[model samples]
Target: MYEFRELAKDVYAFLQPPLVWYSNAGVIVGDKDVIVVDSLANAAMTKNLLSEIRRVTDKPIRFLINTHSHADHVYTNHLFPEATVITTHSGREQTKANLELQGEHSASYAKFFPEFDFSGGRYTVQDMCFRGTFSLYQGAREVRVIELGAGHSESDVVVYLPSEKIAFCGDVFLKGMPPLPLEGHVSQTIAHYKLLESFEAEVYVPGHGEAGTLAHVRVQREQLERQFERARECFQKGMSYDEALRAFAGDVIPLEFQRVVILASYCEFTGRHPETKDPASQSHMSLIQSVADELRVLLGTKEVDKKVAMSR
Candidate 1:
């Protein structure tokens, strides 16, 4: 079950549901309809979210703004048949690439997460794709969707409600800790932070954990800076990326999150060989597989657990 918190007027965030990968979803209610942001991980989870949305309002679902292409964020795209989907062109590109890249190995993921089957998951690149920014007019209110170049993921999007001074920042701003740096460029997270600061929102909704303010955002910046510094130091020492990753502990970041961020940042520092083909992509694929394997042992889990992910 997810707790709904009305952050502004009729805008509510479905906080920390069990089936999600520690991600959140939101609904902005209007007089006649509603707009949603970030669907859940799989069909089952999306169905759960739909039922929750129905319980909250009888208005027709109007729009679905996808924050990014992460499986946990966009796999339910097909479930919202009535909603007009929206995402950035870059976001769409990344979504397609991710689906192509991870589509086959989904069986591997299913081995660990039986509840989530990425194998047959459908990819909806959103009904509309904008490059920089787009605005939606709901009755008298305006919702602006801005593309944050690349952050936790490639071309992450944030929903800004100027009227409420609340920003629904997807994975770009995780609540309690340093958000994962999984983009092709680790430098993007730095710029992402800068953009977030510019927003100056009174209330911020994160993809995971709970809702927070600027203080939580500051914590995110500091933690990420520390990660970058360590990564840089390791790089200067001519240490292997794997070596740099080995040096990280749960204190700086939980090993799992730190591993992914480190891998992405490290590969970024080196270079991405267009992760479509075999050998070059294998490097990343193997790293992800190993990381998942590590997570499995650390949590003693044959299946991924939401509670453990949330507690972090």
Candidate 2:
């Protein structure tokens, strides 16, 4: 059984079973209705969430709010067939795209989890969608669902319960590990953080971290700023993406972090901005230059071991 921790009077969080790197779900039980902030990665995980919610309240789930379109976040929407699945306009669109790629995506994951069933056999599609801010009344308490603009994805929403002083932030801030900017624009992501900080929530529940204060969110913002600045500096210096990654290497930086930085830098140099239409061609001169520049930085920093350098 997965452990459910109550972060506030009506708010609860549970770690997804099976130890999937960074996945968690939350429940908000109001006086009259219940709202699930995010569904789990698969049918089994969603079942666990539903069972746990039943333990706390018999009230029907009035809404299933998706924070983004990530498979881990929305794949289980079908579990709550009766509840309305709501998300930002962009989120809805993205989920539809995700569904189209579900087969291919699942196959990729199956490669990693060879023994596990990757097909989300029980997952359902979201039926309802909204834009900007929308409020729902659960008896007397009002639950505000607002899209804080493109940050982690083209469409990401943050749930706020002013009455409870609690906020459900999906993937905007991950505790312990550095923030993941997989599908985001650095400038917009930083801006989104500032907007999130302006909210008056006392407790913030991240998509993949311990429930804590808004300060935790701010820390993520700081880290993102540092990464963006580093990337930008490398770009200005005409360092290639790989070179930038090599230059930034340190004992404190992990291999995964280096890979992400390199990818992000490459994307930036190639002018592959998120939230935009796909490019006609993936190849670009800017990307080549960026990679070359990055390589130079790496060689100068001497971070790559002699063996690794020779291997390259």
How much lDDT does each candidate structure score? 0.72, 0.67
Compare the candidates by lDDT and give the number of the best one. Answer: 1
True lDDT of residue 123, candidate 2: 36
The deviation in Å at residue 53 for candidate 1 is 2.1
Candidates in order, TM-scores: namely 0.82, 0.81
Tens digit per residue, CA lDDT, model 1, 1-312: 456788878888877732235478989988888899998765655665777778878999989999988777887788888999888898888787766766564755565455444532566677888888888878788898998877677788999898888889998887743466766567788777777777788988888767988777877877777777788788789877656756886463467667666666667777852222322124544544444455445545634455443333
Local distance difference test, candidate 2: 0.67
Per-candidate RMSD vs. true structure?
4.5, 9.1
Q: Identify the leading candidate in terms of TM-score.
A: 1
Consecutive 10-residue window with the lowest summed lDDT within model 2: 274-283
